[model samples]
Target: MSKKERKLSAAEQRRKEKFLEKCSTMETEGYRMENLSFSVLQINLLSVFIALPVNFLFMFSYFLFNDFSLRSVYLPYAPLLFLLIFLLLIVVHEAIHGITWGYFAPDGRKSIEYGVIWQALTPYCTCSSPLTKKQYFWGALMPTIILGFLPGIIAIITGWEPLFFVSQFMILAGAGDFLIVARLLLHRPKNAQVIYLDHPYECGLVAFLKNID
Candidate 1:
């Protein structure tokens, strides 16, 4: 009721309005509202069905050429390597997303954030600020298709079993690709479904969601 309190409230409203406007503009340029209806299971199954056998054959051919054992090479520091590989794969996956989108975004700024969805009990990376759907899709899959698979090929040529590790990482990235493809196929709204971030306070929505629950 006081004048100072009213002034503060007005300032907060203005800030929120500005942020919302920015979000709206970005959405208009990059995404269209859609009804996404695919379940995580469906996407996972599809990805497995397609990627597994292909990856297996690729791995087999790789080892046939170079004679590297994933199990053997992974022994000395399996635990440490798993941790390292997992973290590195995540960075590589997200970096590819950023790079691809950054190449196309109007401002060429791609922001990324990591967090846990306690409800789902998983951590995910959010990629933001793709200028359009094409940029979004390309950025989303670049990691899996490029960094993930190419290294495995290189590893096969060099007889490095670690390439299997990288290939597996690519499969993990493929899982993300599956989800994105399914979501898009099912028609998910951009504001509600797209995962990339484009601003300084990109995690603001996540914080907002957490506070509400």
Candidate 2:
């Protein structure tokens, strides 16, 4: 963390201080740590491009075999109910992040936290403990799989518009997370055992690498 990054959030700075000590100790034990984090603007911009292909592919395929149907079935007060479910799924998305990461966290659920960014109205879950690569990948990805792709695929096959829209929207909503996951996938350190930690101040992660024997 730089001096500019340090001055912005005192609480984040405190966390940064603690982690720096930990990194120093690990460095002595032959581990190297680096900032693998992206800025807020970058994540936001990346999200748009990431979401486009996913939504376009699903939408295009669905339209090839089916009509653009918003009402596949009738429900009482359909618009209101759709709105309600939309809001509810947003909470579920964050919960899945917390739950999956907490399951792998060293401190388990004790290290997990849920918070909202009031300025952007984005809800997020974070795990304070470090995670192995496998653990981190799943925690970063399960929401997109469970709530997004699974349902979206089902909708495409079964011709359910509500499920299709909800799933696609959730997929779009998780674009930032997908970008983070993509970073891990593309930039892995060679011959190193890797660990990733949730970044408190940004939509990113910190990486620690230890060379394998």
Candidate 3:
């Protein structure tokens, strides 16, 4: 038997065409594209190192502003429950990316694509259309802020260990996003309309810039 060729679905084809059209428009407009790439393991490890100080700062600030005392929030049978909750939160983390980015996408929810990198066992949400620098930054950082910083702050004020720990984990998980934002800030073109495209499979994204008239 002969192997059959695979065909792209209509939505996939439209996405492919949209990206290509954007590339064409950019080239005609004298725009250039730059990309960053990293492996899943590399990003995760990098995030850990970057997150340490950030997590510490959050903790330090909390302790400085309020009473600090360690108390056991875990119960005898809570380990399994906590584990399940953690897993569910991870899914929510990715969903946050999709939801936030979707808000800024040209096609709205249809512009977001969610998939997993099987080799790395990592889940990702990518935006199919271009987004402004500020928009992209917020989308990339929303999960970190909502799941990590906000909850962590609340936890500190209320002395809730569970929220504190979960928030720290979320902040660490968002290290790659911080790195991306930093790269954009450092390398983005001057006096241009910057658009970011989240890479479909890679850890980083591609940035395109067009000069303002």
Candidate 4:
């Protein structure tokens, strides 16, 4: 087989090995391993399960009780309003990740740094915290969960679709967080390590993970 095909075959073998190991570990620990892989459908179902109802209730209450709507302000500028709201949601989501990880981190002094790649095409925020795998997963998830429900509530209360869109975007971000969570849950390395991601541009995320005693 070609080198590329060999590499693909090796990766598939490793995946199967990991899955079997995970199953054995879960069985020994009295846990089910079925959902550990966390398929796309499973993630979507989980997101809808946790986010949809909250959004509905939030929007309902806000619109019923408050007078904030496109009708109240500049209806002609709804598109601009939606864009602004979406950006705001992104900021809030990232901020939530920082705050949660920082507070619960071992040192309780995490740092957040921003960087761009390819002359500013790909940009990301790096949050460095001295947290265990479980802690990291929870910290990453807090923002997604909070934004998912909170913005939806605000949207309903204010009768604004922008808020709903914010919640939807939050859910998309949450999908990434959920994937990380799924990996950590399934893997749960014995060493209880921290993780790092290396992008095309280093962006100075050098000390992303620190060994905590």
Measured by TM-score, how close is model 2 to the native structure?
0.86
- Full candidate order by lDDT, most accurate first: 2, 3, 1, 4
Q: How accurate locally, in lDDT, is each candidate?
A: 0.53, 0.81, 0.75, 0.51
Off by over 4 Å in 3: 1-25, 62-76, 211-213
* TM-score, predicted candidate 3 vs. hidden true structure: 0.81
Question: Candidate 1, residues 1-213: lDDT per residue as tens digits?
Answer: 112221223433544366567557755666432323223344445657656765787778785887654574548878787778777767667667666766776666434444443333334444444334456567666777776677777777777776666676677557646565444445334234354332222111210100111
- Candidate 2 per-residue lDDT, tens place, 1-213, comes to 433442334555666677778779878988888777776667778887988898999999899878885564465687787678888998999899889999889899988877765555667787889998789889999988999999988988998888888898889988998898888788667898877888876777888888997
Candidate 1 error regions (>4 Å) = 1-32, 37-46, 71-74, 110-114, 127-130, 182-213
Stretches of candidate 2 off by over 4 Å are 1-14, 71-81
Stretches of candidate 4 above 4 Å error? 1-75, 117-123, 153-160, 189-213
TM-score of 1: 0.59
Ranking by TM-score: 2, 3, 1, 4
TM-score of each: 0.59, 0.86, 0.81, 0.49
**lDDT, model 3:** 0.75
